[model samples]
Target: MSLSRNILLWMSENRWMKERIPKFGFVKKAVKKFMPGETEAAALDAAYQFSLAGIPSVFTKLGENITQISEAYAVRDHYLRLIDKVANRKLDIEISLKLTQLGFDLSEEETFKNFTAIVSKAKEKLGNTVFIDMESSAYTQRTIDFYKRVKKEHDNAGICLQAYLLRTDQDILDLVEFNPAIRIVKGAYKEPGDIVFKRKILVDDNFFLCARDLMKNRSNKNVRAVFATHDEKLIKRIREETERNGIQKSKYEFQMLYGIKTSLQKQIAKEGYRFRVLIAYGESWYPWYMRRLAERPANIWFVLKNLF
Candidate 1:
């Protein structure tokens, strides 16, 4: 990563920075360029608009590492109502969330219960899919374990995997038995060199390798894959590999963050490939926005231009 990106990512996890940064008007203005708004209503409206444009959306209300059971239940309830909202509006949308946000930090059992409640409700009430977003490397094993246990009961659920992690290759192979639905991402966390690829090229290479594995395994019919990236070269490689393998475009999708690459998203959707945008909204957006900047350091220029 570039020096500026490294700084921004470090700041992203700084407790003091995260608590104080979003209080500035300039910061909030920059955030609006990424998220529609910090309310469920705004997020739902954005998804509706995307549906009209022939693109599906995935919504995640941002906040994580809850310390209280009540707080975790509140998060679950919010998603439960979100599922109902999607069902009532008949919107083509899925939901994504962090396990920690559901109470993993407080109690693994409580987190599992909360996660099951939300996903079960989504599956039973609306036939909607739920994606478990991967966090930092510390929680990787536990997250996968929880996902495996959950997958045994609900086939509609999926988990996100970070390509930047050194263990992701083995992780994918291990998950082959489940024929998992995975969203592959070039991880954004500021991780140690020991456990993650420190160079962008290595990360890109691993991403393509993982993509190839997923595409080649599509014959299983249960390996639903989503490539969550904005890198054109990597996207092209995955597209070519999928075509070379004769994998149907319907079996996997390309996902982009909302507002980051509107034109590219439209182009992908226009080509008849499955395309979805992750639309994140909520008051707890500072860390997420900083991570977005770390994902593409050049975007800081865009924010600066808009701000000044």
Candidate 2:
């Protein structure tokens, strides 16, 4: 890792700093990098801006790890409301959700019910797509199983996979059989080296390999893939693979977070490829916001610049 990235990782993982910084104005400023503002209006404003730029979006509310069924259902309700609002505006946007935020820890059945409600809402409101984000290894199997079942009930729902994990190759194979949309990401959570490949180069290599496999083997034409990264070389590799496999440009899209690498995103769009930006909203963003900074250390420079 670069020295800057190492510092970011340290800031993100340091429990002491996490507890202290949010008390200061750091949380507010850090949030502006990832979130437009803390309301649905702020999120919708972002969606409008991206749409106006000819880019599309997938909105997510950034909070997870729910222990209560009621809290999960509340999250479900918020997403359901988001569906209605986005659809009413006829915006070119979709949504992603974390399963744990939907009460996965409470019970499998309850989590499914929450998911069902959210998916149903998405279907009802202008048929926007929904993606369920994959979490840590402890919940990986359950998340995959839930995606399978949810896809059976809803046509527009999907899931995310982390390229860092060892079992992801097989996971992709199994999931493609369901023909659900997928977003492949280099995972953000810190994990033990055993279950996950610890080296950045290996993780990135795995991501490229998976992107190729998806482009080559996905059965449904509309079963799309989102290559979510800021790495230019990785993007180039996927671009080559997509062309080599003769996958139509519209069959897949490039994805990046909202505030990182705006120029790169625009350039990719200008080059005639579809780009979708992930816009995160909500007040519970300390963990998620920190991870975003860790992914690219330049974000820390931005933070520091504003501090003075």
Candidate 3:
């Protein structure tokens, strides 16, 4: 990662900044560029608007790693209601969430219960897959295992995998039998060079390679591979490869964040590729917001502009 990105990722993990940064007025203003609002209603409304533009969306409320089991339960209930709202609104939206947000640290059993319940609800109501949002390196193994367990019971279960991890290629191979809906993203965390690619070009190369690997399994009707990034070069490479190999668009999709590269998102959709926007909202926006800037430090300009 670049020095600016590394610093932003470190800031994302700092407890003092996590507590205080979102309290800044300009920071809050800047975050609006990425998130619709901190409310479920705002998320639903944003999804509705995106749907009109021929772009579907994945919805996630942004808090994670909760301390209390009750807090986890409340989150579960919130998602259940959000599912109901999505159904009522008649929108083309799916859900993504972190396992830690559902009490994974406190109790795996409760986490399993809450997650599977939400999955079952989505299966029934939306007929859609619920995604497991991947976190930092520490949770990687447990998350893969979690996805395996969820996949065994639910066909509508999906997962996010990080391309920057050196082991992701292996993880992708291990998951082939499950025929997973894998959303591959260029990782944003501050992991060690021993475990992850320290250079951006290597990560980009690995992302395209892994995406090509996923696309090769395109004939599998159940496989739903989502390449999640805004890297134009990687996107071009994937597009060329897809066309060269005659891969159908349904075999995979492109995903980007809500505010970044809106024009590219529309152009991709117009080109008849499957595309989805990740729409994140919630009160716990500090760490997530920091990572957004880390992903592309240029976004710091937006925050700086807000300051004036």
Candidate 4:
């Protein structure tokens, strides 16, 4: 990675930086450019707007790594209420979550129990789905294991895979047997060279490889692939590959973050492809915001423009 990108990612994990950065008006304003606001109501309002635009959404509250079971339960309960709201309003949206936020740090069993509760509630009440967002490499295996256990009972549950990781191709192969639903991302966390691809080209190549495999497996009714990226070139490439391979547009969807690439998202949706926006909200957004900047350093110019 570039030096500036490394600095932004390092800052993303710095407790001191996270604690203080949001205090600045400029920083908070820049964050708003990415997220609608820091509340469940705001998130739903954003989702409502997306629905109006004929776009679906995925909601994820901004926080992770809870040290207490009560905290984890609180997170689960919050999502439960969100699910209720989605069902009550008949909204076209889904929920995504981090295992750590559900007490993975406390105990894997406890996390699974908490995760299962939310997924079960979503399935029963909303007839909707929930996705487990993959975190740093440290939790990759554990997250997949948790997904496998819950997915055996609830097919509405899905998990994310990081294309930047060296093990992802094999992971995709292993997961195909279950005919799982997966969201493929280019990964955000700064990982060691041995376990992750250091160059963007390598990461992009792996992303397409994994995506191609997922497309080939689309004949399995249970297989769903979500390409969660903002790279138009990669999206075009995937589109061409899928078209050439006789894959239907409905077989997989393209996902992008809310407030980023709205035009491209609209274009994709207009072209009759499945498109979903990830709308994140909550007070704990500093780290998430920083990672977003790291993902595209050119966004720093956006932040500067917001500041000025």
Candidate 5:
């Protein structure tokens, strides 16, 4: 990564920055360019608009690593209500969330309980997939293990995997048996060079490899794969591979973040490719916002523009 990106990613992990940066008015203004607002209502309204254009959305309330078990239960109940909200609105929306937000740190058993309840409600109400958002390297194995356990009971469950990690190639292979619903993205965490691909080209290459592996299993009806990225070159490469493999356009999906590439997302959908946009909301956005800037240092200009 470039030095600017490296610094921004470092800032994303710094507790001091996390505590103070969100206090800046200009920073908050810049954050609005990514997230519509900190409330789920704002997120849902934006998604409802997208649905009018025939675009489906994934909703996630951002906050992770909660300190209390009661807080986790509240988070769980929040999603249960969110699912009901979607069903009531008849919107093309699904739910994605961090396991840590549901108390992965407090108790794995309780976390599983919380996750299953949310997934069960989604299954009963919307009949859609409930995605488990992957976190840092520290929780990688445990998250994968938890996802495996969840799959035993819920088929409408999916997991995100980071292509930047060296182990992801094998990780994808191991889950092939589950005919897993995997959303592969170039990771956003500031991980060490030993475990992750530090260079952009290497990460991009790994992402393509992961995409190809998932698309290769298109013949399986249960293999629901999503490529969650904004890299146009990599997206084209995946498209070419998909065509060459004779995989139908509906066999896999492409997901991008809200407000990042609106035109490209529309183009992807217009061209008959399945697409979804992830819209995140909630108070715990400082770290998430920093990581968004870290992904593309060029976005610093947007932050700077907010100074006026």
Candidate 6:
């Protein structure tokens, strides 16, 4: 890892740093280049701006692992409000939800109800897509099951898959039987080697292989693939492999995290590929922000330079 990235990860682990840095007005200002703000409005506005610029987005409210049913219910309400606001404007946007935010740790039943409520409301409001994000490996089976139940009722729903996981290929094959849109990410969390492949090359290879399977399968034509990564080589390989395999550009899209690789986002879009920005918003950005820093490493220096 780069020196700057190392510093950021170190900072992420430093509880004092995560807690105190936001207190400094300048620190918040510096981080705004990436975080946008600590509110739903801030996230919506940023996503709207991207939409205007021809870059579609998936708005993810920044929080995770709710330990209380009340907290999950409240998070569901926040999404309901967001849906209402966007529907009034007739905006074209989708929502990405994390199951952990639905009190998965507290009660599986409660989590299912909370997630289903959000999807039902979203579908009612805008008739747009609702994507359930995959959390850590522990919740993988539950998430898949929850998605299965929800998708049975709402065809517009989808879920994410982590390519780094050992079971991802089989998971994709099995889930494709449901015909849901799948976002393939290299994963963000630091998981155990038993559950996830450790090397970047292995992870990238898994990502492409899974992507290829999803693209080539005939029954999975409805299986819109989201290639969520910033690696240029992987992007090129995707482009070449997709063309070589006769998978039309419209069948899949490239996804990137917001505040990183804007140029690549534009470049891919300009080159005739669909691009979607994963725009995150909320007060609970420390962990997510740390993961982003770990991914780019250079962002650590960027944030530090801004502080100075």
Choose 4 or 5, whichever is better by lDDT: 5
**Using lDDT as the measure, which candidate wins?**
5
Off by over 4 Å in 5: none
Candidate lDDT (C-alpha), each? 0.89, 0.83, 0.91, 0.90, 0.92, 0.81
What is the C-alpha lDDT profile of model 1 across 91-116, one tens digit per residue?
Answer: 88899999989989889998888888
Cα lDDT tens digits, model 5, 1-308, are 78898899899889898899999999998999888999989999999889888899999898888999999999999999998889999998989999999999999999999999999999999999999999999999999999999999999899999999999989988887886899999998888889998778999999999889877764664789899999999999999998998788998899999989899999999999999999999989988899999988989999999987
Per-prediction tally of clashes? 0, 0, 0, 0, 0, 0
| Tens digits of lDDT, candidate 4, 221-261 | 57889999999889999999999988888888999999888
What's the lDDT for candidate 5? Answer: 0.92
Candidate 4 wrongly placed segments (more than 4 Å): none
- Consecutive 10-residue window with the lowest summed lDDT within model 1: 213-222
Question: Model 3, 64-182: lDDT tens per residue?
Answer: 88999999999999999988988888888899999999999999899999999999999999999899999999999999999999899999999999999999988988898897999
**In candidate 6, what residue range of length 10 has the lowest lDDT sum?**
1-10
TM-score of each: 0.97, 0.92, 0.98, 0.97, 0.98, 0.91
Model 2 sits at a Cα RMSD from the real structure of: 2.2
Model 6, 1-308: lDDT tens digits are 34555566567657788777767666566567676678878877888888787887788888887667899999989888888988886667789988888888888888778777878888788887889888878888988988888889888888899998989999988988787888889887666668887777999999989988888773435676788888888888988998997778887899987787788888887877888888888887776777777877766677778768
Backbone-clash count (model 1): 0
Clash pairs for candidate 5? none
lDDT of 6 at 112: 76
Q: Deviation in angstroms for 179 in model 1?
A: 2.7
Off by over 4 Å in 2: 1-19, 219-222
Which pairs in model 1 have colliding backbones? none
